[model samples]
Target: MRFFEYQDRARRRLTLLLGLFALVVVLMVALLNILLLYTLVEPWQELRRLMPTAEMLAEHRGFLLWTTGLAIAVIAGASLGRLYQLRRSGGGRGIAREMGGDPVDAEPEDPKNRRLRNIVEEMAIASGLPVPAIFVLERELGINAFAAGFTPHDAAIAVTRGAIESLNRQELKAVVAHEFGHIRAGDMRLNTQLVGILFGIEMIALLGLGMLPGRRARSDPGEMRGPVWFNFALVAAGGIGLIGGRLIRAAIAREQEYRADAHAVQFTRNGDGMAGALRKVAARYAGLNASPAMVGHMLFANGAIDQLLDTHPPLEKRLERLGQPLDEEGLERLGREATDRVRRAVTERERRRREQEAAAEQRREEEENGPLGEAFGAVPGSLAAALLAALPGELARSARNPHWVADLVLYLILHPDPEIREQQLHMILETRGPESEERVRQLRAMVPEPAAEHRLPLTEMAFPALARLSRDEQRTLAGLVERLIHADGRLSATEYALGRMLIEHLDRRHGHGGKTTHGRKDPAGKNARHRENAARYLLATLALHGHPDDLEAAEAALIAGLGRFTGSLPFSAPIPEELRQASQSAAWARILDRALERLARMPRHDRQRLLQAMDDTVQQRGDPTAEQRELVRMMAASLHLNVPLPDAGELFDAGH
Candidate 1:
């Protein structure tokens, strides 16, 4: 099945499972009502006539009503209460913290943490997702992990220490990929919802246990007897409901595990890596010792020992599906190989540590005497390295530092014109106070003029630090950014791009946006005209930006781009008068912003087509200008496309 189809199926299955959970709650209520009637009113003598006659019902109607209402209120109240708690706790971050996870630093010093961070960053960039917050469960020694959140923006992934120390790089990559699969499939939201819903069912049992008389009770025996028997009935009723909840959870979880496993293999294109990790889990099984019931289904593997309600499929079954089922002897050999791999990894890590120490003095000397470009060139070649090299050292450092990131962002938004920039700075001083304005001025002095190419990389590097800000602080920063953008009297393309990137990232991070278009279908043609207009406007905007001096060239570029969408969308090139009007209109920024947001909701296929058209428009006239390139990157980011940015060499070659 296609990616979105899989997502739709998962949603449908979750809805069905929720219905089943509701049925379980209804059954619990019925059992509670029957228990109260049999024990309190009639006893065993009237058990055979449980359904009372009209006269008997009339006599005990109030009692039955009270008992039934109490049961429903408890169950529903607990469920809603749990849901509210999860929502307030900040989604995935809350769950990770609850499980004793510590946030991984943005630039980790340890080898394992660094490796894990690198892998997550690579996958996120490759998949066009915002890099999720990473956490490590330092206390957990089990070979398991889980992803949690309401959406990609607020999502976090936590891995056990055992998984990091035990698995080889390839095996760990497979494991991380498995969790990403969950994130991509929209399973995290469903998993979190299940946790809250199931907790309510479990609360019934907790209430029963709390109500039971303790050994130190000093109540009279006669008075306690009636209460004791009723507590026992509550416990019995709750136990049944808990079991029912687990069974339903297991049924849904097992199928999801299979799908995620398949997704891991597809994403990594390496079945043996995933199969090897599973074999190792079977070989050295140390389950997580925390609240397994609450997070069992979300785990990469089952962390509890309840065979009948195991959240994951059996290892053998999973391996068979991957076409790599192993016998006892094979497992033993794989276990030995895993041990050797871990030992080698540890030795390599030590060697790298020593090498880094030896080179630390040389790096300091180079930094002291050489230019920033020369220093950057000395670093090894990689996408991350290249992007860092392209940025000014002080600016890049500021972006990575949580304390200085806000100041760095303000500096980026400061107007180029001296008069306008002064007004913007005055506004910052007035609104953010003297201390904040001083910091922004200091940042501007450090990087007198940041290049056009520095904007995208700088904004991206600041994301992790931005996530650390409180909701109120983020909201304040967003407001300050908007005021600065409009300080110049007219919104420039650069300003619009930067503002949208910042605001959208914050929106997703806090889960305050509208529904994403993952499983949405537009079968009614309700959005067809809207989408087409968005496409036309986007292409026209890019064309106008690319060839600002020559309208003829701009029209040619626009027509070329619209050609790409001809078969699928009803797109035609705009006339020169329309292009001239668009160029002079002050509302272009607002119109372009709305267009990109609407297009972001397009299905995967249409989005890809739109991106292709945008790229074509930018490249139509020989080499694109720096502004043209920045606009393309900004547009792609807005649409949530997974396209990777060009490396440092490419950026330099593009004349940035």
Candidate 2:
């Protein structure tokens, strides 16, 4: 699906919702002004003020100003306070915890949990996203799941026990894919914002509730009338806010749900799986109690209030869209397929385990040589599986063991050059102390080294463990890793990419400053000069680095890369003088960051062509050398594309 278009639409929807909120505030203010003016004026004066002939109502100007100010303060203060509460709760984690979900194992051992983990990991890697932490609501019997967080790395995926026990592998895969679609399309952030806004409105309703008990307690009958009127006004304002909030929620939720369903179909290429799961949801007639009513919109299906405050389209309509009608035979077949599929998965797992025990080495070699399918967009399941298999056993084990992950990550940053390695060791010793440094040093010696192709996968595996650290501990760890990477006095492509990924993921989890949505390209990309300039900077950097020894060949590569963009250029474009002037400094990192951010804003097709050009430049010397391959991979990762090293040809060829 066109991700950018989806994002643009989401932004527009957010704008519309905000406008609705402002309108509600204005209406509340107007109501308060009318009530306060009536309360203050003498009986005949109040009657005169209420007359339709009082067109401008110039005499009530003071009450209007006072009530408007009070209304604005109440709404703004409540909204701001609620938003702060949500932010402090750490995005989705707070919401999931509130729902009483227990954290599932990162690498689960229970057969059921393991099946779910595998499905989530497969979708994560396929979409070039971090494997989100999983949660399970074992007590809840309804089939439901949700994806929540400000960004992909920090996101959480939670499912009810009913989903796990009922849906087979393909059906569950479809469910998880739908959640991943939410993560990709920036729906989680928007949902959180909506929740905060609604909470503010709910606060007004609550205040009205609190005032009702005091309405009849006044000793003086005349005074009783005033409190009664005031309470009536409060209730009226709160009632409007409450009704308006739900209406807004229903409107936005219904549209996004449909988009998410389509996204799942596109990602998994299986309409029957999702349709079957929804059909099951309908047949079971179940509802989720995993989360509270406020979170109804975030679920795979509506939680409570499915009819009045429904967050999902009707099941029959969904099935019809997927071309799976509600025939009696089709329903029976779905149940049969679910049961048989589970049996097959168990048998397959047993058979694979036995095969692994007998010929582990042979299998490893075979996985390494197999074609690494589709590199640019969603990776094929086979390619993702192969990459996972290639992770070193020790590293994989450490990734699951939270206690060992810090030292393992520290060791991964150790430089290869002997002199630089010593400098890195000394820096680690100074910052982390002897004990922590020694643990990493000893572990480094024991672990088998990972190849260049295995770098990104190893990092991906370590993420769950990295997430285990407290926010402060993560900050310290990030600083130490940064010091070690730069201790060698120069940055290799592998180190640069790994460093970026490490900081990006950790900072996001800790709620540090990072883009909530993926697109960073400036609107100025429409300008021809701006586009060409960005192309020149990116192509020049790639060309100069790819062909360090031959200036002529470097210029040729630059021309070839730029040739892919709009507007013709000279046969050879000179490497911008800044590249040469700043070659000795770390300026290229900042330069590349700016260039790619601008380039990334382009349309998907244009970005693909740009990727193709870089591929062309890197392969100028027949096959790409190890250094060349590493450089390209890092560039792609920097651009938010996690492509497999060997699959670049097939990636571009398939027009992904």
Error of 1 at 635 (Å): 7.3
Q: Could you give me the TM-score of model 1 versus the true structure?
A: 0.67
Best by lDDT: 1
Query: All predictions: root-mean-square deviation over Cα?
Result: 7.8, 7.6
Mind giving the per-residue lDDT tens digits that candidate 2 earns over 448-517? Answer: 4557655655566678778888888789889988878777556654576578778776776765635412
Candidate 2 weakest ten by summed lDDT: 369-378
Model 1 pairs whose backbones collide: 128-642
Error of 2 at 306 (Å): 4.7
What's the C-alpha lDDT at position 304 in model 2?
48
TM-score between candidate 2 and the true structure: 0.74
Per-candidate clash tally:
1, 0
